[model samples]
Target: MPQWSEYTDGERIKILRGMETRQSDLAEMTGLSLQTIQQAEQGKRLTLRTLIRIADALGVDTSVVLGQQAPRRSMQRDDRAMVRDLSRTVHDTAAGLLDITDPPALEELREASKACWDTYWRGSYMEAGALARPLLEQAAARLHDQPADEQAEAWGLLADAYRLAAYVANLIGSRDLAYAAIGHAQHAAEQAADDVRRALVMSGRSWVYLRDTRLADALTLAERAATDIEPKFSTATMEQLVAYGSHVNFAAVVASRMEDKERAADYLSQSHATGARMGQEYRAHGTVFGPVSATTQAVGINVALGETGKALSLIGDIKPVHERVLSGAARNRYAMDKALAQADAKLWDASLETLEGALLAAPQWARHQVLPSVIVSRVATGSTTRLRRVVELIGTASSTGGFPPATPRNAL
Candidate 1:
C-alpha cells in the first residue's frame, strides 16, 4: 500500500471527491468546464486557481487535496474522542443540561478561563479542551446564579470560555461544533454588551469560517469586525488596538487564502501599522496582535500568495528579541511557513531542518498540523534520515493505521 504522500495530485483529488461526486458535479460546483475537471483528475494542466476552487468545492483545505493532510476522517481516535467530549460539553451547557449547585465565583471562573486560553496558545490544545469542559459547565452555572448587578461579568466569562471551546474545535476539524461554540460565544458577548468582546467573537467566527473554507464569508466578517472596532490610533486603548489589529490580521489571512493578493496586501499593511502603534505583543480577549505577530503572520501570507521569495525575506526581519514573545503555537506556525518557503526556493535541506526543529520543539502540536506533512512531502531532496524523523514526529506514516475507516462523504 502506498502512503498518501505517494499519490499524485490527481489521484488525491479523485479520492477526495469519492464515487458519490461525479466529475460533472465537481465541474458545476467549481464553475469549471467538464474538460477542466477531467484534466484535473488526470494530472493534466491543473493550475493553482483551479486547484483552489476544487479544494473549496470539496470543502477541505488545499493541503488535504495536495496529499499533505489526510481527510478529517483519518483523525486519530483519541482526537476524535476529545472533539466528541468537547462537543457534548458545549451543547449540554447551552441547553442548561448540567447539574451544578456550587458554581465558582466570578474571579475563579475568570482565572480558569484565562488558564484555558493560555494552554491553547501554548499549543496544548488537548489539555485546553480538557480544561474547557469543566470551565464551560461552571461558567454556565455561574451565569445562572449571578445577581443582576454582576451578570455582565459572568456573561463575559462564559463568552470567553465558549471562544476557547471554538478554538479547540476549529483546530481539531470539528466544523459544526466550532460553529456552534462561536455562535454561543457571540450571544454571550452581546449579553455582556462589551464591544471589544463582541468584536473578538466575530474574529473567532471568521477563523472558523476560514478553516471551513468559507473564505468570502470569513473575509467579510473579519473586515466588518475590524471596521466596527477601528480605533483612533492617537488615543485608542490597548484593548481596542489589540482587538482591531487581530481582526485586520485575520482579514489578511482570509484574503490570502482567497488568492486576492491585492486585498491581502492592504490588510497586511493595516495590521503592521496597528502593531507598530501598539509597540509590543499583547494577548487579550482570546486574540494576539502586535509588532511580533504582524511580522510573523506575514511570512505565511506571502507563502500562500506564491511569493516564496518575499516570504523568505520577511523571516530575517523577525529579530530574536521579538520572536521570544510569540506563543508556542505561533512560533511553530511561523516555522512551518518558513519551511514551506524554503522548499519553494529549492533549499530542500534547509526546509527539512526547519521542519525537524519545529517537530522536535512541539511534537504534539506538530501532530495536529497539516503543514509539517506538506513540507515533508514537498522537499524533493534532503537527508533521508532527517526527513523520516520529521515524518515520524508528525505521524504521517500511520495517518490512517489503527483507526477505523471513515464513511465516505461527498464533501467535508
Candidate 2:
C-alpha cells in the first residue's frame, strides 16, 4: 500500500486540510505554495519533497504524517512530549474502548495509558517531581523553575494539558481525577494570568460539563477567560481562534445544562458564527468548537430534567452528526444521553432500546456510573441490573470504588 509520504503533494495537502490534521497543519508552516503542497500529497511529479521539507521546516518528526505521532514539532518534548503523546493516545484509545462498549478496548486503552505513564515517569518524573500524579502536574512543573517572564508559555501548556486530561478522564468514569486536574489547571492559569491558558483550562473542562450540563463552572470560567484573552489575542494567532470558539460552545452547553432552551440556541448560533471564521477545521478536533447541536445538548438536558416529550422532539431534530476523530468514548457518551432521554419519556421500550444501543456502543465506557444519578430516583427496583453494570465499571476505575451485579449476569 502506498504510504502518505508516497502520495504527491496534492494528496498530502488534501489530508493536511482534513479534520485529523494536528500534525499536518504544522506542515503548512514551511512557507510552501499550496500547489506544491497539494502535489506532494498526491506524489505527483515533484522533485522537491515538500513533506520532508514541510516536516523539517515545522520542526516536527515526519512520523506525525503517518498517524503514529500527534505533533510533528516539539517545543521541548521530552517527558512532557511523551506524556502529551500518550495522553492523546489514551484519549483516542478510550474512545475506541467506549465504542466497543466492552472490556477489551477499555482494558487496552487503560493499559496503554498506564504503560505510557510508566515510561514517562522513568524517563522524566525524577527530574520533575517525585511522582507522576497526572499529565497536567508534569506540565506545570516546567514553569516552576523558569524565570517569571518566561513562565507564561509553560503555564499555558500546563493549563491546556490538564483540562484535556480532565475532559478525557470524565468520559471514562474518572470524574474525581477529571475535576482534580481541571482544578490544578484553573489554579495554574490564574497564577499565570495568561489569556490563552486561562481560556483553554476553562473551556476545555467546560466541554465536559456540557455533556452532563453540570460543568458550568467550566463554561463560566471559559467566558471570563475569553473576555480577558480577547484583547490580548489577535485574530492572526491560533490562540484567539481557540479561545473565542471555546466560549461559544461553552455557552451553548451551559445553557442546555441550565435548561434554558432559548439561551442554548442562541449560544449555538454564536458558536457556528465562530466556526465559519476558522480558516481550517480541526478534523473532529472537537477540542475548540464541536458539532454538538444545541438541539442534542438540550434534548439530553430535558431528558435529565424530566421533560421527556421535549427531549424526544429535540432528539428527532438532531441531524445524526458524528465525528471521526472525537474518540469512540465521547461518541458513546452522546449515545448515553440519547438513551437517558428515551428512558425519561417512559418509553420503556424506547429507553431500553437506547440503553441497548448505548451498551453496544460503549459497554466498558458505559459502566454504571454513566447513568444519571437522578435516574435511580425515577427507576424501579427491577431495572437496577442496568444500574449495577455501570456501578461495577466505576468501581473498576476507582482507586477507592466496584459493584456486584445484584443478579450476577456475566455480560462481560
The candidate scoring highest on TM-score is 1
Model 1 scores a TM of: 0.79
Model 1 residue 265 CA deviation in Å: 1.0
RMSD of 1: 12.1
| TM-score, one value per model | 0.79, 0.48
lDDT of each: 0.83, 0.48
Residue by residue across 11-45, what tens digits does model 1's lDDT show? Answer: 87887776557899989999999999999999987
**Least accurate 10 contiguous residues by lDDT in model 1:** 403-412
Clashes of each: 0, 35
Candidate 2 C-alpha lDDT tens digits along 127-203: 22112234333444445445788766565555555555565444433345566666766776787677566666766
> Per-residue lDDT for 4 in model 1?
66
Evaluate model 1: give its lDDT. 0.83
Question: Model 2 Cα displacement at 171 (Å)?
Answer: 6.9
